[model samples]
Target: MAKKTARIKTDTHAVRLQTRDDVETAIKQIGDLQRQLEGLAIEQNNELAAITEKFAPKITALKAEIEPVQQAVQAWCESRRDELTQNGKTKTGSFNTGEVQWRQRPPSVGIRGVDSVLESLRTLGLTRFIRVKEEPNKEAMLNEPEIAGTVAGVTIKTGIEDFVIMPFEQEV
Candidate 1:
């Protein structure tokens, strides 16, 4: 096997606006390009909508044909599940065309009226079921930066800056 060579890229032609006139021209060009991009996106979406509208009726008909057949197959399989799965020894039944499986979803807990439930649990001495989460308080740390900064793993970051350019456009 031949060794693959890595292709490195370098920025040789970077934009450098020297004067106010050049900056103003660049902003005008950015606004024009943005308008062109928005026009192209609208055209592409119109074409996609036309294509979807053309095929939507056929898709609806196909789905209507499939639902009854799927229901029939599922009912037949469910009625003969004991024989198909060999008396619950397996979860899947293999046939010439494909295999069908019976799956049990994992159990989940649902809660409603959280405040009342918590109060009842506390009154009944069932605190073990109630969870208490303990984590670092970042807001408190921000309030007391002097004390928080003294910690070994924590560092206070400052003076972050970003450069942004917005080209103004007039609505017609």
Candidate 2:
């Protein structure tokens, strides 16, 4: 009876670097490819910038023309807002071209001198207005890992290894 040999599975598409020289060659190739990619990116950006520069003046001129017209339309709308919106029954005025809307933004609070306000709130016994945030102190946990690791919910990971390949390149 002949013994059957076990066959190991291998990825067909994977690059196999058999020796130190192969790895070095791969790294050099990577560096060359990176330089080529960067050059292409720079060329693409230059072309895009030239295109933008060519269009910018026309865009600016159009915008300059539109601004005063838009202001005039807004002024007209504001002057006859009640009639346009049918005496506050609707917030939008629908014309043949498009609709203009009067939108009320949600109220917002702006605070200046936050420290002084917080101190005043504290002195006035207005603790309800003050916010107290509570969270796990990871730095303290790292400082005392033995105690931290004993906690049921927390798992302290150690000796994590990562493989990295950095191709050599010259700085411009």
Candidate 3:
């Protein structure tokens, strides 16, 4: 006579169900680690602030002493640069110690009274130079799927989510 034994199936679902307690324990550990990290970061910032405060006065004084000498050197360099324009280059010039160059950027135009400009544009109904800008309303977008689909260059992604300790809660 032979005895038959039933064997259990090994699958991911079975394994997950068996290890549910382990998963919960890992999540708790991660939460504790995050709390510890936040506390350490705050403590480190406070210590750094104290050290910076102790040295700030000396640093300021050193910078103040160097300013006049630096300004004199810069003035002399500018004079030399004007004289050494023989190479037909306006941006770059080399002096005794090092090379000096001017880096120019494209000019940008800024409007000061934006509300008045908008009002004028709206009154005149100008569409070429200026037009009313329509920003996406978040609540409206969430309620309307058709509008969300029509919008371009928008991306949806899954982000890492974690539990945060509430400030009002007592320490466990």
CA lDDT of each candidate?
0.83, 0.84, 0.66
TM-score of 1: 0.72
Q: What is the lDDT of residue 80 in candidate 3?
A: 78
Best by lDDT: 2
Model 2 over residues 83-130: C-alpha lDDT tens digits? Answer: 999999999999999989999999998999999999999999998999
How many steric clashes between backbone atoms does each model show?
A: 0, 0, 0
List residue ranges in candidate 3 displaced over 4 A: 1-35, 121-127, 131-168
What is the per-residue lDDT of model 3 for residues 63-167, given as tens digits with 9 covering 90 to 100?
A: 999999888877886777666655546777777787666677999978989889777877898746575478867776667766575769654333445433222
lDDT against true structure, model 3: 0.66
Q: What C-alpha lDDT, on a 0 to 100 scale, does residue 31 get in candidate 1?
A: 67
TM-score rank order? 1, 2, 3
Candidate 1 off by > 4 Å: 1-15, 44-51, 112-125, 150-153
TM-score of each: 0.72, 0.71, 0.54
Judged by TM-score, which candidate is best? 1
Model 1 misses residue 37 by how many Å?
Answer: 3.4
Minimum summed lDDT over a 10-residue window in model 3 is located at 3-12
